[model samples]
Target: MVKGKLHSIETFGSVDGPGIRTVFFMQGCPARCLYCHNPDSWKMSDGRETDIDELLHRAKRGMPYYGNNGGVTFSGGEPMLQGEFLIEAMKRFKEVGINTAIDTSGTYYDKNTRGVIEQADLLLLDIKHTDSEKFTELTACKQDPLFKVIEDIKEFNKPIWIRQVIVPGINDSKEYIESLNEFIKDFKTVENIELLGYHKMAIDKYKKLGMEYKLDGVPEMGKEVMEELRALVRFPGKEMKKAC
Candidate 1:
C-alpha cells in the first residue's frame, strides 16, 4: 500500500473545494510564505503515515454530506510533494464515484505529478506572486515551476480557481493588482479568483510551536482595503468572487 505523510484531515471541509467535502492536509511544502498559518505542515517527516485505502474509507463516511457538489479534496503543505501517492488515491476516489480535487501551489509539476494533476476534477491553485523576484520574496521559493504547471494544465481545459493571499503593503498596491490581473488573462480555465485578506490568526499556532511569527506586528488587512483590492479583480464578464 502506498502511504503519504499527512498533517491532518478535515472530515467536513467546506472551503477547500465546491460543496461539503473531505479535505486532507498532507505533510510537506516547498514554500515558506510569510503569512502561512500551518507552519506545522512544513516538515515532511513529522506527520502520521496515511494510506490511500484509509483515506478513501474516511471519505466514504462523508459521502452523505457530499451531496452533488461534495467529494474529496487534497490540500497541503503542497500535495504535489506526494503527487504519485495522491494519484493512486485520487484514482481510487474516482473509481468510487467521488469528485476529486487538489489544492496545490502548482510548483511541483512534472511528468508523473502532472499526470495525476490532470486527473483531478478541480484544481484550487494558489497563485502566490506573479513577479518572480517578489514571488521568491513572498514564498521563499521560485515561480518557474508554478508557471510551467499553469501552462501545462491549460491544454486540458480543466477548471481552476485561482487563490491568492492579498498581503497588505506587500502586494496590495493598485499597480501590483493590475499586473496580476493582466497576468491572469493568460489562464482560460480560471473559474474565479479568490483574494484572501491577510490575518494574524496563526500567531498562536506559531507561538505554540516555539517559532517566531514573522508578521507578528502586522495588522490584519482591513475591510476597506480588502474592498479596494476586490474591485480591481473584476474582468468585464468573467466570473469572480473578490475579497474573500
Candidate 2:
C-alpha cells in the first residue's frame, strides 16, 4: 500500500477550493517561492505517513460540511510530489462521491503524476512567472513544467483555477500581465484566474528555521494593484470575463 507523507490537515478550509473543504497539506516541494508561508513544508522526511484508507476515514468525517460543493483538496509543499499516494487517494475519493482537488506548484511532470492530474476534479495551479527568464530567477530552477502541465490539463478539459502571486517588482509590470494573458488564453479549460496579492506572511517561519527570507523589504501587494492587473489580463476564455 502506498502511503502519503502529510505535513498537516485542516478540517474546515474555505479558500483552498469550493464550499468547505477538508485540506490535506502533503509534505515536500520542488520549487522554493520567495513568499512561501509554510517554509517548514519543504522537507519530505519531516512529515508523518498514512495510507489511503486511514486518510479517507479522517476526510470522510468532514463530509457533513462538504455537502455538494465542498470535498477534499490535496495541497502542499506541492501535492504532485506524492503522485502515487494522490492517485490512490483520488480513486477512493471518487468511489465515495467526494470531489477531489489538487493545489500544486506546477513543477512535477512525469508518468506517475499524470494519473494524479486526471483523477482530480479541480486544480489550483500556481503560476510563478509568465516569462521563462523571470521564472528561472524566481523559482531558482528553469524547468517549464507549468507549460507542459497547462497543455496536459487542457487535454483533460477539466476545470482549473490559475493562481498568480503578484510580487512587487517581479511580476507586476504591464508587460508581464499581457504575457500572462497570452499564455493562459490558449487553455480551453480554465474556469477562473486568481490574482493573489503577495504578502510576507512567512517571514517569521523563516526566522524560526534560521533561513534567510528572500523578499525581506518587499511590501505586501495591494488589492488596487491586483485589480489593475485583473483588468489588464482580462482572462480570455468564456467571454473573457473577470476572474474570481
Candidate 3:
C-alpha cells in the first residue's frame, strides 16, 4: 500500500496551479524558512497517513470542478520530502486522466525527488531569495540544492511558475527585480512570475504553535507597492506576465 503523510487538502484551489484544482498539502520539510506560515506541517509524524487509492477517489469526486486546465497539485511543507509517495500518487492521478502539478520549495533532491519532478505536468517553484546569502539567512538552508533542482527541471524541460514573497524592507527594490529578471532569463520554461505580498497573517499560526514569529514587526506589503513591483518585473523584451 502506497501511503503519504497528508497535512491537509484544498478541494478547489485557484492559486496553486491552473484553473481549479485539488491541492494536497503534504507533510515534512527540510528548510526552516522564516516566513513559513504552516509551522505545524514541518513534522512528518504529525500528518495523517493517507492511502493512494483513497486520495484518487477524492480527486475523482472533484473532477467536475477541475476542467481541462485543472487537475491536482501536490504542495507541501515540501512535497519532495515524501518523494516516494508523491511519485506514486502523481502516477495514479495521471493514470486517471488528471493533469498533475507540484508546488515545491526546490530544496530537496534525490533519485526519488528527480522521479517526482520528472513526472509532474507543471511545477510551482518558490524562490525564497535570489541572493545566496539572503537565501540562506531566510531559509536556514543552503541554496545549492534549489539550483540543482532547477537544473534538473531545465534538463527535463518542465514548465514552471515562479513565486516569491516580497518583503517590505528586505527585497522591495527595482534592483532585486532586475536581479530576479537576470536569474530567470535562462529558463525558457518559465510561464509567469507571481510576486506574493508579504503578510503577517501567519503570526497567529506561529503563536498558536508556540513558535517565534520572525517577521512580527514587519508590516504587510500593500497593494500599491505590489503593483509597482509587478510592473518592474516586466522587462523590455520578456513576455512573462506579472501575477499577484
Q: Candidate 1: which stretches are off by over 4 Å?
A: 235-244
TM-score for each predicted model, relative to the true structure: 0.94, 0.94, 0.95
lDDT of 3 by residue, 1-244 (tens): 7678999999999999889999889999888988888989999999999989988998998899888899999998999888888888888888889899999887777778789889999989999899999998888888988898888789999999999889988898889998888888888888878999998888989988888988888889999989988988853247766556
What would you estimate as the lDDT of candidate 2? Answer: 0.85
Residue pairs with backbone overlap in model 2: none
lDDT for every model? 0.85, 0.85, 0.88
- At residue 105, candidate 2 shows an lDDT of 80
Q: Report lDDT (Cα) of residue 48, candidate 1.
A: 94
Comparison by lDDT, 1 against 3, better one: 3
Per-candidate RMSD, Å: 3.1, 2.6, 3.0
Worst lDDT 10-window in candidate 3: 234-243
Q: How many clashes (backbone atoms < 3 Å, residues ≥3 apart in a chain or on different chains) does model 2 have?
A: 0
Model 3 misplaced stretches (Cα beyond 4 Å): 235-244
* lDDT of candidate model 3 versus the reference: 0.88
Residue 106, candidate 2: Cα error in Å is 1.1
What RMSD does model 1 have?
3.1
How would the candidate models be sorted by TM-score, starting from the highest?
3, 2, 1
